[model samples]
Structure formats: structure tokens, C-alpha cells
Target: MSSSLPSEKALVPFVSVENMMRLVHHIGIETMLAELADFIEADFLRWERFDKTPRVASHSREGVIELMPTSDGEIYSFKYVNGHPKNMAQGLQTVTALGLLAEVSTGYPVLLTEMTLLTALRTAATSAMVARRLAPKGARTMAMIGNGAQAEFQALAMKAVCGIDHVRLFDIDPLATAKAARNLAGKGLTVTSCTSSQAATEGAQIITTCTADKQLATILTDNMIGAGVHINAIGGDCPGKTELHRDILKRADTFVEYPPQTRIEGEIQQMDPDYPVTEFWQVLTGQAEGRRDNSQITLFDSVGFAIEDFSALRYVRSKLDATGLYQELDIIADPDDPRDLFGMLQRAK
Candidate 1:
């Protein structure tokens, strides 16, 4: 190794926000979303190999902070994130995160990256991956309620992974809807801004709710959702927050990433403890069914999960060599002599 290069054990690859954006632009956002879906699906297929748990959260009146951790024997990963809905009004993001990937054997970090953007990508990819299997066949239109930071990513992911050709957008804030519309203008999707949630759902085969408010708000009611459509309710991710009504859950065949977590945080929080839900990994592994019929309604009650973030970090690690978008972070202390820590410090002095 060159003297100029930091010790391998001390150097961890770091992808900063600028690098993440550059990588997204380098790979193209839609293409990256498609690729990420592939990675997420592959991990889901081998779901039993991982250690899964609900995120450990610290909740306050304003927002919640969480630590999501998981491992697949060979590698371990975790993410530190916060959800503060009122931050948007204060000129801050509603969600921000950082993630780490490490070797399970040595417990040494291999990569660290800003996941605020990556989270948006992974969440969109996760939704689209599930929609690919559960949405009505040949689905071409999507209704995107809550056009906030996550709106454009969800639209493009659906377009890339599920072949959606049109997206009808609605939001409580008109500016947010316009922002999403403007961002998605030339992305080969027909963008329509609707006056109401009902208008957005008209003639749409897939409905995605990604609102940011931290409350028990019903973005989609049972009457608005008809047969033969898929609902991707991603906004209701915490204990008190939900985007769909209880009747909708009762009417649809719900799927989830992890039930224990989703029951506490997802749309099904309103349902009984025994509310039947098929884990999506089971669907990918062919152990369960996805869409039963043309008229069947499939609801993916997504609350996000650690395995998905682990896959995202793994995907980023795989791309670091090809993209060279990461910098080596000297975060670990390496002593030349294994048993002479004090001697190594004195030698340095």
C-alpha cells in the first residue's frame, strides 16, 4: 500500500450528499430506481437469511428518531433517521438519515452514506417492486396523493418498474403538487394535477399515498378505492400515523414487509391483532399469492424496513468502485502493534 493511502482497516468509504446526487445523475434516477428494485427483490427472495426487527424509536411531541438495524450473516447495517413533519415549515426536510454497513465478523464499518436521498430511492423502489407483482396486470396509471419530497421518486419508480405511463397527483398543498408536476414534466409520464383525492383516483389502477404529516389522517377512504386497483400506502409509518381508513384494510388483501412492525406503524394498526397479512418476501419466494384476480384489491401497507436499507447500502457499496463517487473516511484507529497501544501512541509522538 502507498504511504499516502490510509490503512485499509482505518479507511471506510463514504458517500456524501453531493456524491449521492452525482451518482443518481450519473446512473439516471429512473434507471437507478429500477436497479435498486432488483437488489431489494433479490434480498427479499432470501429473506430468511437476515436478522429482522422493528426500528427502535425515540418519540417526542414534535417528531420521532429511530435506529433501524439488521444483518444477513455476512454483513450488518443500520440507519439513524428522524421524522419531523413540521420541519418543512421550518425550512428543513421532513426526513433525514445516515446509514452504515459493516463486516459482521470484524464489526468494522465498510461504508457510510447519507440516506436521506437513498431512503427516498429505496422506499420508492420497495413500493414499485411490490406493485410489479400485486398491481393489476398492464396497469398504466397511478394516483399519487401527498406530493411532497417523495412524490417524484414514487412516480418515476412506478414508471420504471411497473410501466406506469401516467400519474395523477394530488396534495393538500397546491405548491407541493405543482412542484412534483414540474419535476416530472419530461419524464415520459402524463402528469395531471387534481383538485381532490377523489379526482386523483379516477381511472387509476395504482394509488400511492406518501403524505408526511405525523398523525392519524386518512388520505384514502374505502369508497374512493374500488376493486381491481392496488394501494401503496407508505405515509403511515409510525404508531399514530396512517394514510388509509380501516374499511380499506378490511376490503383489500394487505401485504407488508414485516408484520410485527407494520401492525404498530402501518395502516393495519387500526385492524385487529389477528388481521391476516401475507409478508411480501413470501410472495417473492412463491410461498404465497400476490394478485388473486382482476377485481382483487391489493394493499401494500409499507412502513419501511431494515432489510431494505441494508440492501440499499449493499447496492451503493457495489457501485463505489465503478463510480468512484466515495471518499475514504479515516474513522477507525489502527495501531501497528496489536498489543502495544501505548507504545504506538508514544512512537507517533
Candidate 2:
């Protein structure tokens, strides 16, 4: 029992899937979504202060595994994630993730958590945040084109952040639409299950397409979309996987998280290399415009970004103390003598 024992530096907070779910329930999902949106927006405002890069991806015929990393001088964070559309048919999740946060100076990890849930929250928050700015004013109804695991989160985020009260749902699989409709039954939303994509978009001011296919597919055609609506296309997150018709990209003004990354992974990948696109951060900083007129078509080609995951990790870290939902793991080795690694190990024997 020496007072010289290692301090709390040896322990790192870890949030597991169960703890993350409890934390969400504790904060209330809608409230958490709104707060996460604020955190993401604050980070976007300081976009230039961060080190940003496109996620490094390894693509296979069935799926893609990616590493998304970013740093803000003080803290460093990265998320290990994968997208396997085939997993769903195998009774598995289409996406799964884990994230880590560390100190920039010491290169020591401070937080390790299951990001499968956090990613859903942050992705939905990002979409709702952008919709609040780019969606037509007084927009209350949304068309959710692909009702998968992300459907409820996206719908509630829109309700919580963008004041959406109704969501029209459709999926190639009727079961997904039924699942979404059943889950959203009494969640303060008017949920409608539609048979086709075209039926879902009727009277909806916001259209969100989130299909999970590893190849190019048209979930929304040009004629299916109308003027004065915002399109949040979140499914096309890797090369050769897109959800919109090329003509739609030609007709609408597209905004993205990072141009270089979006051009490689987003719907804009179908466009010319020099095709013009605006980064959403510019809209937040008033350096660029959003939704010029009521008749304008605004498209948020959301391919997800490292900075958004960074913001999510930071947000979860901020809640650890108050919620006490995280566990501390002894992950770092602190020897009596910093340089005597072998000597410290011998003492334990």
C-alpha cells in the first residue's frame, strides 16, 4: 500500500452497448439528439481548427471497413466502423462501430466506447441539424425511403430538431416498413407505411434515403422529387454505392461534409471532378448560402465524416461523470520508473 501507486491515469472510461442505451434513455433520445446536434454544429463552426481527412476504407465485394480519424490539436479521436449490407440477411447488423478518444500530448487514450449506437445518434443529429437549416421552412412531413435500423432515429431526430410531425415510410422489404411503423406508433409522430418510394414522398417536404445495398441503385428518381424540398441521402457512403439518380444531382444543389471525401464516396461521385459543391460548414459560418429560394432543391449528400464522430465521442465523454454509466478500465501501464518497463513486470512475479 504505497502512496506512490499510479493515479487515475491508468484507467480509461468505457461505455458499452448496454451503458450507452441506458445513457440514451436517461437523457431521453430526442433531447440527446438535439444536444448532439448542438455539439456537432459547434464543431462545424470551428471546422478550420481541425485536421480532417477522408476515412480510409477497405472495400470488398460484400462490404467496406473504414477508419475515420480526426484531431483538434488538444484531443484525438477515431472510429473503427464497417458497412456490410449482406449482414442483415444473415441476421446481423448492417453496420457496427467502436470509437476511441485520446490525449494529443501523451497519446494516451481517455475514452473507449461502443459507437454502434452513438453513430446512429450522431448521424441522425447531423441530418436533422442540416435539415433545420436547408429544409423548406414550416416543413412538417418527411419521406423516409429506407426503413432500416436508422429509420426511427432519423424520424425522431427530425421531429426533435426540425419540428417534423409526420413521416412517410417505404422500403423494398415490407417488414422493415412495418417495423418502423410499429416502433413509431406512439412516439408523437404521424407514421404512414407506403408501398412505393413515390408514394412516400407525396406531400413530404424532406426526403431521407438510407438504403443498404453495396451497389449502385436508384432509390429516388428525378421525377420523384419536387422543388422546395431537402434531400438527405445517407446510404451512399462508399465507392460505387449510391441512391439517387444522376439527373437529380444535375437538378439540385449538393452540399457535403468534406468535398474530397464526398467526391469519392457520395452521390456527387457520379458528377464531374470539377462539379461545384459547398461544404456545410460554410453555411454555418455564413460563408456560403443554403436553400436560396422556396423553389430551390437542397441536397445534403451525407457520407458521414470523422469530425462528426469526433464530436460524438466528445459529447459522450462529457456525460460520463454526471451519468456514472461508464466503467473505468485499467488499460495503461504505469511503472514506478517510467523507463523501467521490464523491471516493473519482474516485481509483479
Candidate 3:
């Protein structure tokens, strides 16, 4: 660590987990999620402007690590994230991440912050944003099928972005359902803890499945879903991981972020490679149709995308000036003479 404060050029703003939680509390979770949805929706409107691709991932028996990167000609952002469903058994987070935002011109990082919490927030925001467009009109209740780290965020974001006023929670573990219900209480939404996924989906217009299972698991079967409902399948994010059954994909008007990527990592992975799916940005831009009718079963196969993280970085970056919740880290070796590397090292010694 440097004894003296680093110069502005040598520093990058960092938001630690504590600071991140503080910032969320400062903005209020609902308001922050709504703002995040706005940023994500705006980015989707200019979808063609971005340099988009699938996340680069390396999988292991223990878990997977990924790098999700994107840019829109000016600023570039990427998130380094890991997913280990087994980590909870070892007292670890199922997902942890750090993100960076850089100036495209300089290639220098302007912001570097932990993104685990932000990722959950953005994922929920993206789900809610998509729900706003594809969900059945007047969607006031949602069934959250997995009561893990993402359950509370999803419930609240739906309320904030899609006008969902009630959430029914269910998880294979009753404790998980209880935990989610506890977290959701007093949030101005009616919280119900149910015994099973089928029970949770009862009378729900929106169904959000977010179980963090690395293996392919059928959190929702075809029979469990109904007409005029929107499904936000959240946890089928890896090559072999999926939450909804293949039959469900066949019947729903599936929407995805990037087809090339989603085909490999999303719920559509269960289908034939030639399976038809709509690019969600097209719906936002009026280039395609969404929710053809009140009886249409719409599915947002959310594998989580890079642009949402980019939008999240942009949103948090915009708030730093007002929140003052970041630290300047001396991460770059900035010397008086760029070419005199050895001289600078000698001076440091």
C-alpha cells in the first residue's frame, strides 16, 4: 500500500461490500432497483450499439468463474463473477463478483467495485424490466420459486418495476422459504410461504424461478405453468443447468437477451439448436412482437447478461458523486516518467 494518497490518475474508485450495502440502503432498495431498471431498459433500447458476446466461462466440478464484458463505443465494463451452488455448505456465498468500468479512450479503469450484491440487484431489475413488457397486464402477484440469495430482491423488484403487490415463496428447503418470507415482511408486499412450487404458483400472474442448482433441475414443469402468465426463469445460467423443463420452452414465446449466448447457457439449452426464440431488445424497440395476446405464455429465459451489469456499473457510477461511498485505491503504477520504469522502482526502494 502507498504511504501517501495516490494521485487521481493512479486511483480507481472502489466500493466494498459494506459500502455497497450502505449505498443500497441510502437509495432505498426499491428506488435503486427502479433506477437500475431504467438504466438497463435504456441500454436495451440501443442494443445494436453495444459490442455484445456470451460470457467467457471456465467450469469446474466445484463451480464456474466467468467474465461478462461489453461496451457501447464510449465506456467499457466487465464483471468477474463466480457461481458455486455448493459454497453455501462451506459458509460461502453462492456467487461473488467484482466489476470494472473503463474509459474506452484511455483504457484506464475509472471504477472498480464488488458486484455480488449488485449482480443480484441487476438480475432482479432485468427480470422486472422484462416483466413490465411481457407480463400479463395488471400483474399484481408473483410466485418466487427459489428462496435463496435472489428471492427477496426478485420479490421487491417485481413490486417496484412491475407493480407486483404480493409474493409467494417456495424452496426445496423450508428454511429457505422461511428466510425469504422473513426478509420480505414489512416491505409493503404480502408474503406467503408455500410448501411446493405448485402451491406458490397458485393465482400468480408472474412466476420467477431462481434456484441456484448447478445440475439440470426441473423447478417448473409444463403442467405447473398457466396461460396469460409471465415466467422469469432465473437460474438456468450454465451449459447443463436449467430450471424449467424442456416441454415448457416448447409452449412459451421465449425471449432472450442474446440468442447466440442464451442458446448455449439459458433454458433454451434444453431445446434443439434451431429452436425459435425472440431477441428481447427487439420487443423494447418495436422491431418485434411481445405477448401476442392475453392468453400467451411468455417466458424471459434470464441467464443474466453483460449489458445489465454494464448498466448497473453506469447506475452506481452516477451515484458516487452524491453518495461519496467509494475509496480511491492505488492500483496502477503511475510514475513521473512513463518510460522510466526501472528508475521509478529504484526510487520506490
Query: lDDT for each of the candidates?
Result: 0.94, 0.95, 0.93
Of models 2 and 3, which has the larger lDDT?
Answer: 2
Candidate 1 C-alpha RMSD relative to the actual structure: 1.5
Inter-residue clash pairs, candidate 1: none
Error of 2 at 67 (Å): 0.9
lDDT, residue 97, candidate 3: 97
* Candidate 1 residue-wise lDDT, 75-179, digit = tens: 999999999999999999999999999999999999999999999999999999999999999999999999999999999999999999999999999999999
Model 2, span 103-162: residue lDDT tens: 999999999999999999999999999999999999999999999999999999999999
Clashing pairs in 2: none
lDDT of 2: 0.95
RMSD of each: 1.5, 1.3, 1.7
Runs of candidate 3 exceeding 4 Å displacement: 1-5
* Lowest-sum lDDT 10-residue window in model 3: 1-10
TM-score, structure 1 vs. true? 0.97
Instruction: Tell me the tens digit of each residue's lDDT in model 3 across 132-193.
Output: 99999999999999899999999999999999999999999999999998888898999988
